[model samples]
Target: MSAAQDPGTPPRPHAMLIAQITDPHIGLQPGPATGPLDPTGSLRRALAHVRALQPAVDVLLLTGDLADSGRPQDYAEIATLLADTLPTPADGGPRVLAVPGNHDRRAPARQALAAAMPVAPDAPGDCVCLHVEHGGLHLIGLDTVVPGAAHGALAAEQLAWLQRHLTACAGAPVLIFMHHPPLISGMAAMDACGLLQGRAELGRIVAAHGGVQAIAAGHLHRAIVGQLGGAPVVVAPSSSHQLTLDLRPDAPLALRFEPPMIGLYRWTAADGIACHFSYVEAFGPSHPI
Candidate 1:
């Protein structure tokens, strides 16, 4: 694909709401593992905020950091909670989407969400991709989980799959989802977990393809959106608890009950994409109708 468009032609952007929910640190207890975090409880509250949105959302994307530990049971817990709580077409709401993060154990996560897992059981690999078309828009979810590492990387296999999908889409506008950020944000300490090992190769793949509208990710426990090698990247905040960024090793365990955040990304065939964020408060500001 060429960088500059020919005269009389302009880059086209797809319009759709891709709701990104990240880092709902499940199974977090109030003790050492969680460091005074209430992951399960917090996620419940956050869901309430999401349920009350005025305009409603189209697609639901969970950005990862799924379980506190990479245990099979933790994954089961996530599957159960998500099925009951999150919005979906069956429940008169948006269809749910997800990708695995560092905290997510690929094996168990794959077993439970068999639909999303790449190769089926007895297959050599595990990964899943979804194609959703809503109002002249398409969204795709990609898996980027690597076993036994604080850092994140997208494998050659996954990239190959992404390439094929983008090629198939042709001119259709698309949004890519993953567990790790393809790029980094500020805050030195948290940046360690932000690296994608084969990023250069991934860039070339995206460079070769022109349909990707934006890339959204989860990790870092903070809200950030920026450009990566010419692509838009948005990082969603965790619903469970946030990792306070303090480069100092000696700083006290800095965890707090900052209300978890949820997003409302609005897209219109005429207007392109826009986003808004709000927290899980006890009771939202009152209004007169």
Candidate 2:
């Protein structure tokens, strides 16, 4: 069976399996196995996991935080790793898609993923919002990063662009991906720095759009589910260390060396979209249930 296949989800020959790898946070150098976690190493392990998936995934969605410091060299390193690790088909297919995180620099990220992000004459050269259509589904990448701020917010122009695109989809199944989730996750310190002010406007657009299937995001470093504007919103965990899972109102800011995780989104006309979470790092030998 493919690593992405969930035994519970009976195989559907026509289903699209998309691998979601978020928040790798690769640094200037390779990550170490122990001590403070290394983002690059974690990313390598995640990629390996994706490569091992049965029958191969239709596409890989990288949900942001590609670099730890948004540095030029860091992006260069990421570009190199992606070139080396991403699956390439003899038929020359679309293998990966990404958006920028609050930790990513616009110019550097744009340069790094130039091919995936072609220049639109009407759009800014540095615009990170991207639209892609595959197998009758629409995937939109929304830029939620606030300049020079840890928090995220969608500007008026972004919300407008989103509505225009969603409107054009004409009721096709749409899945939106962004760095910061539009809703609060109850992690006090993190929620305090969550997607700021613009969520309502974005929510309004989503609620009005009937085609949107789900909004997926990354940033909290933990898998979570919530709703924004009546649409299902999913927050994918990091491929590296996770944030401490504290739901208390007074929870302190902290990180934990938890086993990394990734999300697999299985899409079919019959099922719509079904998401399954799987750990990237192996723990022990598998035994038959």
Candidate 3:
């Protein structure tokens, strides 16, 4: 019989819950022909859904593309929304953590969000890298934005810093969160703009350390699963809109009105980690069978 089936086995400990919301694209404005895309409304719904979850999440992880344009006003709007929607730390709200995407201005984002999620002081330049611990789990956020470009990369200095942190973890479970995914998604247009540099080095580092339980990222605007150095990589869907799912090599970039979603990660000592996607829309109440 399995451990779960055996009465002698103790029950697993409570898992740490993390809600991942990504690619809100807060300032995006579509042309007249496409009609209005309510990015802000979608984000509000996402936050409401997270706020209603029972037992509550331990952390709220934003995986980038927070703003459509790198504008200080957009970042400020995001901060205002967070303040209005979520409860304060004193009121039992989960801690917020974030990294920057290509659409973000590093300095503006840092200024707006620093009070909630502070970046590491040792972070080189304007990168928003972070390292924090909760309940023995190590959370690492990497800033993968390439200024004025859609593609992403990791600098050599950042890689060295990451290596030092992973080395210090000493076999503790680690979860790395970033904006761009290192693996290809078969969406040709999106893959063309995916992580362009240092992915191999990142894989090497994860493989060498053997402590990374998983890597969570957001860029593809769809829920995707892949592997890097034998560790699982999960790509979260956008909270505002989604990319067209065409995989043809010549397929052009396109957007669709697919249901917006958020990712939830459950991590326990007995069961490493598992990811689930929750739609942002409400479907009324459920009835018993």
Please list the C-alpha lDDT of all candidates, in the order they appear.
0.65, 0.78, 0.85
The deviation in Å at residue 252 for candidate 1 is 9.3
Worst 10 residues of 2 by lDDT: 1-10
> Which number leads on TM-score?
3
Pairs of colliding residues, candidate 2: 2-54, 3-54
**For model 1, how does the per-residue alpha-carbon lDDT over 10-102 read when each residue is reduced to its tens digit?**
233534455667888677657765465777777766665666665565567777777867678877876777667765565556556667788
**What ranges in model 3 sit over 4 Å off?**
1-13
In angstroms, the error of model 1 at 262 is 1.8
Residue 122, candidate 1: Cα error in Å is 14
Using all chains and alpha carbons, the TM-scores for the candidates as numbered come to: 0.81, 0.89, 0.93
- On a 0 to 100 scale, what is the lDDT of residue 177 in model 3? 94
* Backbone atom clashes (below 3 Å) for every candidate: 3, 2, 0
Q: Which stretches of candidate 2 lie over 4 Å from their true place?
A: 1-13, 28-34, 89-94, 119-121
Top-down TM-score ranking: 3, 2, 1
Summarize candidate 3's per-residue lDDT along 147-217 as a digit string, tens digits. Answer: 99999999898998888888877777888999999899999999899999989999999999887988999
